[model samples]
Each structure stands twice: as C-alpha cells, then as structure tokens.
Target: MSKFKYLIDGIVKNNPTFVLVLGMCPTLATTTSAVNGMGMGLATMAVLLCSNMVISLLAPVIPNKVRIPCYIVVIAAFVTVVQLVMQAYTPGLYETLGIFIPLIVVNCIVLGRAEAFANKHSVLESALDGLGIGIGFTLALTCIGLVREVLGNLSAFENKFSSSDGMLVFVLAPGAFLVLGYLMVLFNKLKDRKKKA
Candidate 1:
C-alpha cells in the first residue's frame, strides 16, 4: 500500500544518500569510520524523526509564509537535544562529529522531508518516512565507513582486518568520494537491471 511504498522509496528507490543524493555534507564528512558513521546517522535520524513528526502535526497551524523558519526552529531544538545527550554519554563520538552535530539543523534531508513529505502527510506516515530514510542513510554511511575502514585502516566494527597497513587514501576525504562514487555506480547498475527485468 501507500504506507509501505513510503518505506521502500526511502530505503531503496529514493535513498537520501545514494538515490536522491541529499545531505552529502554529513554523508561525506562524518563517515570516516563505521562507528562515526553510525553515530552520525543515528543523530541525524533522531532529528529527522522528531522534526518530521512535529512539522507534520504543526503544518496546519503554521503560517505558510513562516513554515520554513518554523521547521528550522523545531529541527534545531531536536538537534540540541541529540547534541547534549551525545556529549554527556558518548563523548568520543561527540568530539569526533564535533561541529557537524550542530550542523544537522541545516541538513537538506531533514528540511526537504519536512517540506516535501512531512508537511503534506499524516503524522504516522511522516514518521515512517523519516524512519525509512534515516535507516537508509545509516546503512549507506555504515557501508561506506566499513569499506573505508577495512581498506584504509584494516579494521571494521572494531575488529582488526590485519596488522598490515591498509591503503591510507581510503581513509581520507578523497577516499570518501571514491567509495561513494563507485557505490553509486553499482547501485545504479543494479537498479537498471531490476527495471529491465
């Protein structure tokens, strides 16, 4: 049904990272390691879910002229909550993500979902959309992080791949782009094959 479609769309068909290509800033910047990627993804997911639900609930009451600002305010509030909680509990990740944590306020995925999907959808639907997109984003980042980690640092999920040195470039900014680009190509090829069949 329509509800299921939203989930599928966000995860596979219109994934914010690979398919729609939104929020590339955090996608590229925070995915230096699997832990960092998952942390950033979860942080963004929390904000995305909260903002989507709140925005959907308030859409009717919010004035059209000021909706964007209102959405940003709501998102910023949630981002602050996530930031504080992470800082208090996960200081290492907090320090690793640093300014990017606060920068979630402007992530296009959150704002775009608020405007494009959440505002127009029911509360439940908005939440599901956020969840699906958030998961997809998380998975994408984790995969990229895993690849970079294994190849660049010879580790994954805290497991050592080898004592030998990995390709250092895979851990750098350029490595992020290289991995992401190739992943996009692979995803597109699979999608094309699916369509043809």
Candidate 2:
C-alpha cells in the first residue's frame, strides 16, 4: 500500500503539470495537436521510466558530490534511446517535436524525479513514481491538446467538425498559456472541492 501511494501521488497530488507545475516548456510547446502532445508525452514517459529505474539501482554507488551529473548521464542515455526509436518508426512525430525531443534532458520533471524520488527510493517505487508522473503528464498534455485542437482547429483528433476555423488564437503560443491557466484553475477548483468533501 505504501509503494502504491507513490504511484497515486504522482497522478493526482503531485502531478507534474497542474500540481507541481514542472516541464512547462514541452507542456506548452509540443501540445499544438493531440498527436504531437501524446507523442512527446510517451517519449518522455519512456525516458522517465527507464531513467528512474536505472537511477534507483545506481544511486548507492554514485558519489554524493557528483550525483547530479551521474543522474543526468543516465537520463541523457534514455533520452537518446527514445529519440532514436521515434526517428526510426515515427518520423512524422519525430520531425514535429524537433528540438524538444532532445530538450527532454533538461526537463525539470524528469530530473527532479531522479534527484528527489528515484535516488532515495527502491527500484519498484521509483518505477511507479515515474510511470504515475508520466501518465499524469501525458493526460495533461492530451487534454490541453484536445482543447486547443478543438477550439483552434475546429477539429478533434484531426477530425474536422466545422469547415471554418474555430479560434485561431487557441492554436498559437498565447492560446497555450490561456488554456494552461484556465485548466490550472479548473483543476485546483476540483481538487479543492474534493478536499472539502
């Protein structure tokens, strides 16, 4: 039950998006469409999962003075794997994500997990944390992408419901901020209500 809490905490309480508010760059940039958002989210998840387990296994041997660098090297290795896999099989998404794919190395969510949770926890716990946080992040991105695509492109999952554009601004950078802000508010309200109950 204690181990499972690590998983649940990430998805709801410590969500990288709405709660902790980590990884804002990719959260905003890669979510222009649901496909792109999911692609990025999955790629990040893969890296996070692999890196977390590896970091947990290696934490004991890593010297305290250089733990950060060691963690980053582990993360970068996983990110490279994800990038190569995406480029080979999903070239379109690979192209769409562009530099952001490589930029996952610096994403606060991944690194923060490594330093904060993975290093201190067992491999199974770390893996759960990574998976839960990854799922939360993916859901957040997908929801934002869905909203943006539906409103901005007048489509859902690329299916056009209206011949005319919905709201062009929702597809732009400004729209990303607006949607994120609104969603943050909504999430907080729901969580607040849940707490009150």
Candidate 3:
C-alpha cells in the first residue's frame, strides 16, 4: 500500500527471475558479462513497459482469444526498435548479444507480465511491475555474470570468445547451468529459512 512497498515488491518478493522464473533465454545468454546483462535487462524493460502500457490501454477492447497475438505484436514492435537501435549505435553489443535480442519478444517474463499484471492493472502500476522485474532480472544475471567472469576468466565479464586470462573451466555454458542450478538451490534454502524464521 505504501509507495515504497510497490518498489520493494517488484524487486524482491515478485522478482521475475528468482521469484517468477521467467525469461530464461537472455538470462542464460547475454549474462556472460555485467554489461551484457544490464543491456539486455534494460532493453527488455523498455519493451515490457511499452507493451504493458499499450496492453493496459487495449485491455477492454482486445478479445480474450486474440489477446495473446496482440501482446506479441506490441512486444515485437518494441523489440524491433531495440534491435535496430542497438545495431546502429552499439554494434558491439549487437554482435555480442546476437539472437538473444530478438528473443526478448518471446521471453516469458515480458509476455507473462503483459498478460497477467499489465492488462489488469493501471498503466503506472504495470510500469512499476516491469521496472521491478526487469531490475531483478538484471541483478540476478549480473551476480551470475560476476561469478562466472571472476572464477572462469580471472575477470568480471570478459569477452566470452576471448580467454586472455586463466580459464577456470567453469564459466562456459555447462558451468553456467551448474552455477544457476546451485544458485537456485541456495535461494530455495534461503527462502525456506526465511519462512521458518
């Protein structure tokens, strides 16, 4: 009910990544670097916010059966905007991010929020949801990215293609899966303890 509660709810209790478990594609891909993770997160946030606002506007008119397709159209439009802008300005990120950029359209987190929270809520509240979930996704990816970069490349978020430093053999795709699995287990245990306390 408080203003800060909205903010906290978005980032913590209702985190899209750790809590809702959406958007696993970019979560697994561009998260190799803090920068990459941040970029993807922000891009997705922009699209989410835009789509949420539009969906909220059209919620009354959109047929329930066709709502899914409508959401995709809105999301795809925003994602195309991101792809073009990124390709034009941040070509390096464009290259590094690769197919994942386009994949944001299908990201469960984006579409899920659009269908669930955004359509039902006010535009402002939906924006808050997007902001909260987007930031949470960024933070989780950045944490994993930091860990992978440090242990695997002797740096935080070094180029995935270039291993200029010592290779710890635990930062690749398989290692990321291992780390994500362990992190999920650790988070689950923490959640259990929190409930107990």
Candidate 4:
C-alpha cells in the first residue's frame, strides 16, 4: 500500500475507535465532555506516533523472545513523558484523564500497532500508520463526547446551554455504551453503503 493509504485507512477504514473497537476504557471514561475526549485522544496520538517510530527503528535488533517486553518499555517511556507533561501543563485535564493517561501504555491500539504494523513497516510508514490511527481515534472520541455532552449536559465542550439537565443518563457510564453502540452502527452502515456504491 502507498504511504498515504496508511494515514487514510486509520481515519476511516480501520479506525481504532469506531472500526477496530480498541481503547474502550479511555473512550468510555474520558469522553464526558468534548474537551476531555479531545485531550485524551491527542495524548494517545502523541504516544502512538512516538512509539511507532521508535519500535519500527528498533525492530531489527529486538529479539523475538523479548520483543513484547521491549515494546512495553518503549510505550511506557512515552506514556510517562505524556503523563508528566500533562500533569505539569494541563493539570485539570490531567486530573480528569487520571489513570487513563498512564493506561495508554497498555492500550490495544498502541500495542497492536507496535506489534502488527510498526515492527514490520518502515519508520515512515509506521509513523504514518500511527498518525492515521491516532486521528481516527481522536475523531471518534470527540464525536462521542460531543453527542453525550450535547444530549446529557445540553452543552458542547462544557459550555452550558441551559440550566436544566438534558438526559442525565448520557453523562454516565451507561450512556457511553449507548452512544458508542449507535455510532458504531451508523459508521458501519456508511461503510457498507460506500462499498455497495
């Protein structure tokens, strides 16, 4: 496949969130608001990009037996950097994201890309793949967050539209699953329609 295909595929065809259904913890937990969702997505993207490139570069020398451990170390390193930076700069978002931030080290999307794509692809290709997947994940979280916020809070990005709550359920755990299920169906339908066309 071409380099650009790596990028586009993640955003639409092989989206981590909507398509692959990876990273559900952060997706469901942090997306109570658009800003929180976007923040978590961007943080994951940063880790993915860096880890993919590093893993791709180190693939040749990494022993097969130790590869998984090495990958974790690399991912953990980047995650620590992200955690510290977020803690220092965006303390509120940092707090909101909380444990989910560090958990990116174990995120399936990140690790799966490292093992499945990064280890085999060139550095550039791996980076692009990471970026594509990251963008896709970001968009999915943002959309879910937007929907939940608008419906539950009667607001967008925490901006209040009215004094009264819209649908309290949407702001809670159950609402994440509800919104995700509907969005997943909607996305799949679109994909199927495009394929038929």
Which one is best on TM-score?
2
- C-alpha root-mean-square deviation, each candidate: 0.9, 0.8, 2.7, 1.1
Candidate 2 deviation (Cα RMSD): 0.8
Best by lDDT: 4
- Using lDDT as the measure, name the better of candidate 1 and candidate 4: 4
lDDT of 3: 0.80
lDDT of 4 by residue, 52-106 (tens): 9999999999989999999999999999999999999999999988999999988
Candidate 2 regions with alpha-carbon error over 4 angstroms: none
**Candidate 4: segments with Cα more than 4 A from true spot:** none
lDDT of 1 by residue, 29-85 (tens): 988889899999999989999999999999999989999999999999999999999
Better lDDT candidate (2, 3): 2
For candidate 4, what is the total of clashing residue pairs?
0
Worst 10 residues of 2 by lDDT: 33-42
Question: Candidate 3 on 71-120: residue-level lDDT in tens?
Answer: 89989999999999999999998998899999998999888988778888
Residue pairs in candidate 3 whose N, alpha carbon or C atoms collide under 3 angstroms: none
C-alpha lDDT score of every prediction, in listed order: 0.93, 0.94, 0.80, 0.94
Q: Please, what is the TM-score per model?
A: 0.97, 0.98, 0.90, 0.97
TM-score, model 2 to reference: 0.98
